[model samples]
Target: MNIAIMGAGLSGLACAITLEKAGIRPAIFEKRSQVGDRFVNGEALLSIFTHPDRDNIATFSDQYGIYLSPTSHIQRMELFSKNKKAVIEGHLGFSNIRGREQDSFEAQLERQTKSTIKFHSEETYEQLLSDYTHVVLAAGDGAYSKSMKNFREDFTVSIKGVTISGKFDRYTVMSWLDYDLAPFGYGFLIPYSEKEANLSIAIPDIPKNAHVHISDLWDVFYQKVRSQLVQNLPITDQFQITQYPIGICNSPRIGNTYFVGNCYGSMMPFMGFGQYAAILSGVYAAYDLCGMGNYEELMKPLRQSYENSLVLRKAMEQLSNEGLDRIIHSLQGDWADKLFQSHRINPLKIASYLLRPYIKLKNE
Candidate 1:
């Protein structure tokens, strides 16, 4: 009874670790020689796992024994429009340590398990399926399974960032909303420490050539900096730009192979946060392989959240600057807290959200 997992990324490593813990030895194959090698040149960032629920990163790490260190803790988030700004307080931290050193998150996970990965094994899904009893497609972003039926181009984003040295609030992360700047996207600053942070913006290329290039996103960011949207976030001359396509996968299981991470379309639609989903998908795949539970059922909340976020994003795109301001203002109270804590959204919340503008209009 041999099992094989493709890709040595967080998703693949996570699946391997889970299976290994269950006393199941799964062969791990990666095209790259080492973990995090593919993302070395770019400025990569992922949210710190601090959800205020059973689904938080810490709880998952403890349960699975995967150690993740937080570079910065964002307990406060400020939202902005051209004429409106709102501050919401809660857990919104992130980890920038991925692929930083030779031995980082993925590397540490590999080392802790004392497992060996078959590097340079660029085997395709068809090849693997013929080889192992069960296969897990934990491939990272853009690697789709053959069973992925609806692999549509949801959005393409140009992400450019700089590591600036200045006095920054380590506890706070900020986002700006302007249809002109991001179109259907947004800009943000995630500070890893008080002295430095990764400042970047995601501009969606929705209408094909609509949003255009990374320099345009930078121009918008410069304007925001001059306007002091996030107080004093000084930008050094040092920076790099990278772009990637992100989308979702409809089915968790495709044939005899189970999909995880970006390969399965686990990436969230709104903010491009997929690390949590990626890790959880790996865990769920392992459990399903062991007959503990169905991967689709275990991942229902995450899938639902992805769908809910898509609805919210579409609604946001329809809002005017003033409407965006009103929405940001509404997000400051208890609703904001609840919104970030839960991974999934229910029908009642969706209904209330749809009627929110009318309620506000009636109140006015």
Candidate 2:
């Protein structure tokens, strides 16, 4: 089968690799000259593989033989405000190879596959469609897909993020989330080393009726947060400043063409773990479309995960809009923050949340 994948990010590339493994030829169409350049420069951070590779990220690394360093052992997880509280169960997700400079994961995938990825590439969805038997819209949602009538919605208060990697005296990701610094959003002091950490803050756009970009938020939020929290931490290593529009989509885009990864719907309202969802979605789309397995059976997990994410995300967004102040205050004291974090960040919970989703999908 001749397959053309649009957008050479994780989802597209992974799909190509899977097809190749199945003895199919797939061509990648990328808008950027270099693979992962956008994602790399964008400061993407994902979960360390606690799940299996069927849709797990660790499987992707192993499949391609990409070596990733563990940034932290996840020593502690505690939320703080006026009072410091220890989160009961959910562990801290470590910063993975995506944040590291040495090996950009996208490039490695491209090189390993010998998959034809015409870089610095550009063409319309129609132009691409004419060229291949199958055109997988690997570009995550936002771009209009001919297969789908509408685009996914951006959920969070769009934010600009500045991530810096340097030696920090602080040990945990929670160490940096002080009111002085990361109000509106949070801070992650991901332990790259006992001494080094990836200090990141999500600077949110001004709410409701405000005109603000990420840079403005970064300036205001950083100054505020840093003044209260890490006043003494050296800003010596200001590595990169990148902005990503984050939020859950109203729904995942599914049609004749498959939209995976950021294109399908980022599925990241908190700590960007869209790659996991993206991977799983890619696997399902590939297997189903390629006619390799039971259509419903192969896609059960994938559909469940996506639908589960959508349902919870919609609920949370409604909750946020309806009573955000009260919710934030509650999170300040109780498990509200933990719940908020988990609803989006925790895949295990997400999977469990999908129990009914799978059943409903099977019914439909």
Candidate 3:
């Protein structure tokens, strides 16, 4: 079967690699000159988000024959609210570099694939459909899916981030949930190494946050990071994204065309963690194409996770600073350990179910 995969990002590359394993070398197309050709940033793979299977890298390698090396294992995570701070330590997850770096996840995946990618190509979906038997749209975002009338946009987020040079604990990641600094948004610091990290904030687009200027919020967040870390981190590079869509596809497969990655709505609405789900979507799509499995059936868990995360996101948006402070304080001791370290408990699902009534009440 002739197949074409769009956008050589995480999902597209994963799909290509999986297809190759099944003896199908699908044609891959990338709009950029190379894979991961964008701003460099640090991202986390939280074990809580990918429960039942901790150590995502190992899971990928062992289960799917996809090997990836993380920049560092996340052993500690610091959560800061407006009035309280909590530290949770253990085998949290991992931190990996994203974008143009040679060791980035995209580069790692690109190396594993034997399929040739047509880089710098402006092949549109409509154009590819006429040439290939099946087309997999993994364009790294929901734009193409939305254009195809297959995407249901839940929300958009404004993000501003920078790569800073500073002393950092590569295994520790920090996050801020203070509304004064980011409104209904959150700030994070994910270190790529002992001397470099990506500090960023993501603010959801809602009416209450309509007047929130990201630059102003960023200034506050930067100062907070400086005070908390007690370092004047020098920014080496910066990037800004506005109205970035976070949503899901109505269906994983529509006709012979498949949606994967962010295009498939693998990104969770709660904290935007979906690397595992995104990779799985691609592999699942490839499996469906090879007549090994059904794409829709494989994506059920990911879709459920998205729905759960959306519920939590709605609840979080309604919370006041006092509420956030209480939540952070509650995560201080044994509770934090149980919530983060326990493999049996899916915190996202539990939290979503518990907060559903509260969310409904708030909405009413």
Candidate 4:
């Protein structure tokens, strides 16, 4: 079967690697000159986000044959609200570099694939669909899926971020839930190393946040970070994204074409964590192509996670500063420990079910 995979990001590369193992070498296409060809930043693979799987990297290697090395194992996470702060420590997850770096996740995945990636090619989906028997749409976003009338767009987000040179705890990640800084969104600091980190804020595109200036919010967030870290972190590079779609495809497979990665809605709407799901989607798509499994059936859990996260996102958007403060305060001590370390209970699913009624009431 002739196959063509779009975008050499996590999902595409993972698909290629898995297909190669099945004795099929798919044609890979990447718009960028090379893998990881974008702004360098830090992203976390939180264990809590991927319930039932405590360690993401280990599971990828053991189950999917995808070996990845994280920059640091996240041992601590600091959560800050408008009026309160909470710290959760333990085996939280992992932190990895994204984009352009030799050690980035994309670079690691690219090294595993034997298929040649046609870099700097502007090949359109319509053109590829006609030639290849099967096409995997892992274009790193939902644009093509939306164009194909398969995307279910829930919301859009504006994000601004920068790489800063400062003293940092590589194993500790920080996040803020102050509306004054990010409106219905949030801010985060993920460290790439002991001396470098990515500081960013994301604001959702809603009517209440329509008047929210990203630059203004960024300024406030920057000052807050400075005060919290007690350091004048010097920015070395910056990136800004507007109207970035965060949603899922209506179907994992439509006809002979398959959607994976962000195109498949691996990105959760709650806090934007989906690296593991994205990679898995690509592998699952490859499996379906090889007649090993059904893509739709394999994606059920990921889709459910997306729906659960959306419920949390809606509830968060309706919360006031005081409410956020209370939530943060509640997460302190034993509550935070149990929430992050629990394996028997899927916190996200439980929380979503509990919050559904409140969300319904608020909407009415």
Q: List the residue pairs that clash in candidate 3.
A: none
Instruction: Quote the lDDT for 97 in model 2.
Output: 40
**Model 3 over residues 39-99: C-alpha lDDT tens digits?**
9999999989887787898899999999999999998999999999999999999999999
Please, what is the TM-score per model?
0.82, 0.68, 0.98, 0.98
Candidates sorted on lDDT, descending: 4, 3, 1, 2
Error of 3 at 238 (Å): 1.0
| Candidate 1 backbone overlaps, count | 3
lDDT of 2 by residue, 120-239 (tens): 777878787777666777776554542354443433444343344444433345533333444445555554444444455653443431444445445655565456555545543444
Local error of candidate 1 at 249, Å?
Answer: 2.6
* Global local distance difference test of model 3: 0.92
How many Å off is the CA of 69 in candidate 4? 0.4
Question: Worst ten-residue run, lDDT, model 1?
Answer: 41-50
In order, the Cα lDDT scores of the candidates are 0.67, 0.51, 0.92, 0.92
True-vs-predicted CA distance for residue 35, candidate 1, Å: 1.1
Off by over 4 Å in 1: 40-55, 92-96, 102-104, 146-153, 208-211, 226-243, 332-364
Per-residue CA lDDT of model 1 for 48-81, tens digit only, reads 2223232344666677777666555557777887
